[model samples]
Target: MKIEKRWIISFLIISAAAIAGLFWPEAVETPEILSQFGKTEDIVPADVAWLLTASCLVLLMTPGLSFFYGGMVGKKNVISTMLQSFICLGVVTLLWVIVGFSLAFGDPIGFHIDGRFYSVVGNPFSFAFMDHVGVLPHLKMASTIPFMLFALFQMKFAIITPAIITGSFAERVRFISYLFFICLFTLLIYAPLCHSVWHPNGILGTYFGVKDFAGGTVVHMSAGFAALAGVLVLGKRKNSSHIPTNIPFVLLGTGMLWFGWFGFNAGSALAANGTAAMAFATTTTASAAAMLTWIFFERLNGRKVSALGACVGAVVGLVAITPAAGYVTVPQSIFFGFITAIVSNLVLNAKAMKKIDDTLDVFACHGVGGIMGMILTAIFAQGENASLLHGGWNVFAHHMMALLLVSAFTFFGSIILFRITNAIIPLRVSEASEQLGLDISQHDESLDPNRHVPMTILDLAK
Candidate 1:
């Protein structure tokens, strides 16, 4: 279809939906608690304001990631690589609104046949189409923000998680297949992990007391491990060249991701309180420390400090601190950043030596960093809650157990998902098409407008 016709159709459909929404029974009422400005309220306005702002910041990270990943790929595949992340913004958001949120955060379903299953996942029907997820504060969850806002905030995380995996098979995967796999991944892998770790009655949280201040396990580790699986399934790119097309774009993406990460970590606090403040401070400290540590290590390895190394190191720091941001102090985060940068750097080097084609080092940065963060969080998590450093042996043990379980589940489950998606739509593109470049073969687009010179009437007639 022509682009103009497509836009007209989309506009008409959206306009019709807006008109229909105005006539529907008013199920979504602004809560009385939020309406009162001058009096004491159940929902704090400050919390609402902060959470909303944080949500927007988190949303920006996906495009930031697109640029980051895009710049790292060959110029021939940059648009294809970027679109893989950009499409998640649209595809994942729709999936979340439909049933994804319910599956991850709706009321837990209990079984009494034995002791209790407690809920493997939230009741999908309970909040299907966001039935009760409205402006009213969901007392069971964040009590200060609208339930709808909370869901929307969570949606940003959902959008970015699968986007993270595209780095694994950037140049070789078919775009349609990529889209299907991410959608399937969100429902099968991402949602279940989110429910298990974050939901109040979740197995890991309620039964194991595994603490993930943000999404060490759910987002970072899952994406990382799943990325490993994707690399294994998709195999190596035909041209496994490590040449980066755009260092400046990588820097821009790094800056955006670093900015967005404040929301990614602090927003998990769900309240504008001391915890949020602590999280923000720790996130900043950890990222800076990691960036410096990475370049320092590069110098030691006899390689000149490069822009790509700094960006990757900064990102690794952000991943390492995510699980500990709200729980640990700034000094602890400095250690977290420094240690994680070293660990990821070592693993990345090993991966390159082994010739593993995990493009962009998703597993090395997110997976390894997240596991390190989870373990560190158990050691240094301060406050009233006890950590291993404070004699909380059981909590430490549970986090270790949770880490293993999450790693195994994500890795194996992603393999199964890749096979399933591949059965329906071939995952890898034809070698001929890949040689021609995904930009021209798949999308008929390119970063350089001059790649296709204009054809004269004589050429067209020919």
Candidate 2:
């Protein structure tokens, strides 16, 4: 049993980081002087409790996504596909604790552009090793909850975003190389986009006034575009067409995702208030509308209604409604679901899209859905954040700019990261590995006990 050199190097790097973390000082030396975070009195118990629950709910989504993707791939690839999503839970969490959280939410590091100091990314050392991340409230970000709780909640979002991309190149990606790509994607692409859109001093948030209430842009759009880039870089799998391994798994995953989304959307409010309730309502309404619209739209096209179609439609609606969940009315949410589902469904069926071997149609469903959501958010937002429909042309214009910027950045940045990873460790598995199936070739394990494991790549070379 010869261990690969890459595995040895990866282990050493991870172990070194863990050892360093153990030696790092606590964020706060004294419990009595927690005032550095904010007034302890400002922490609201209800908000804290709700955020804790929401974090757990959001964490569940990654495993749910694993099942959703696992069911869609070939039987031989199911375990490998599922593990890709599950691995992120451990990998991204550790990365986040190290510097991912800091790179996303730390103090602004930017330069002057047209007399405005536009912050593009956060300072990586600001919260490095969870420094200064404690129980007290962050006066600006989420005043009602512990700063650490907010970081943990956001960590769930970070974990799921990269997992979403695994579906695009599923069944063929080398597991170890996939690991490297995710770390790069999170640091270079995800953290920067997250900072630009969600951070208080970020260019898109403060300068452009872009309103992504949840993460249509940060999570879905980034994942979708990155998935597209991955498809381009990895090319098509050797044998692309296959029947799903388990429809029941897909249905179960969909249910879990739908149930967990209430927390994903409502939790964005960072409170247990009227805004949270409204967001919860809109999330439900949008997904319902999308589910019905998907099946009925398929019937209109002379295609039989399918459970898979319904699940995809419902997920699209969730993606489309995410940016507008708190900003738009419940009635408006129905329109978001209806329109987004129609658009993504059309894209999914497009001849051009079919040519691109995106194994799971991640781009059509999530990328297209997210773009529609952002555009609709710019058109339908109300009250103080009035959109195009409400005569706030400025907000609408900025949103359009932000959309283009985000798309280009995520797509191109991902391609670069993929290339870099390939250079370090080949991104695609060998043809033999693909033919044998990743379960047996990559993991040396299989769902079928009777299935034979192939020789190692090194042995095959001889």
Give the CA lDDT, 0 to 100, for residue 35 in model 2.
Answer: 40
Q: RMSD for each model, in Å, please? A: 4.9, 2.1
> Please, what is the whole-model Cα lDDT of each candidate in the order they appear?
0.86, 0.92
What TM-score would candidate 1 get against the native?
0.89
Task: Give the top-scoring candidate (lDDT).
Answer: 2
In candidate 1, stretches whose alpha carbon ends up further than 4 angstroms from where it belongs are 1-40, 110-117, 351-353, 453-462
**Best candidate (score: TM-score):** 2
lDDT of 2 at 370: 93
64 Cα displacement, candidate 2 (Å): 0.3
Clashes (candidate 2)? 0
- Model 2, which residues run further than 4 Å from truth? 26-36, 113-116, 454-462
lDDT of 2 at 216: 96
